[model samples]
Target: MDVFPDFDGMRGIGNLQSVAGALLMFALIIAVLMLIVCAIVWAIAAGTGNYQIATKSRNGVLVALGAAVLAGAGVTWLNWLIDLGSRL
Candidate 1:
C-alpha cells in the first residue's frame, strides 16, 4: 500500500508553504551573512592578537554554518520523508 499526504485536504496549506519557504530563505541569507561577518571579524581579531574575540568570532562562524546547513538540509530531509511515506 502507498501512503501519501493530502496536500489539498486543508485550507491555507499553500499560504503556509509560502510562508515557510520565505522564512527558510530569510534564515539562509542571514546565516550566510553572519558567517561572512564572523569570519572577517575572526581574521581581524587574530591579526590584532585578540585571542578572546577571535575565539568568539570563530564560534559565531561555526554557529552560522550550522544554521545554514540545517536550513538547507530541512528541505532534503522533508522530501526524503515524503518519498519514504509514499512508498509505504
Candidate 2:
C-alpha cells in the first residue's frame, strides 16, 4: 500500500504553512535572544562569585542553544522525512 501526504486534499493549507513559517521565525528569534541573555547572566554571575546563578544560567545557555538548533533544523528534518516517506 502506498501512503503519503495528500497536500492538495486539505483546505487552508497555505494559511497553515504561513503560520508555521512565522512561528519558526519567532522561535529562532526568541532562542537567540535567550542565548544572549543567558550568556550575559552567566558571565555576571561567575564574575560575582555566584556559583548557583552561574550554574543555572549555564544550563539556560545550553537549553537556548538546543532550542535554536532544533528550530533552525526542524524544517529540513521534516522535509527529509517526507521525502523518505514518499520513496517508501
Clash numbers, per candidate: 0, 0
lDDT of 1 by residue, 1-88 (tens): 9987885566664565667667888888999999999999999999999999999999999999999999888766655655565455
| Native-structure RMSD, model 1 | 3.8
Writing each residue's lDDT as its tens digit, candidate 2 over 1-88 gives 9986775665764565567767887999999999999999999999999999999999999999999999989866655655565455
Model 2 misplaced stretches (Cα beyond 4 Å)? 1-7, 78-88
Give each model's whole-structure lDDT.
Answer: 0.85, 0.85
Overall local distance difference test of candidate 2: 0.85
Clashing pairs in 1: none
lDDT of 1 at 19: 74
Off by over 4 Å in 1: 1-8, 78-88
| Candidate 1 positional error at 58, Å | 0.5
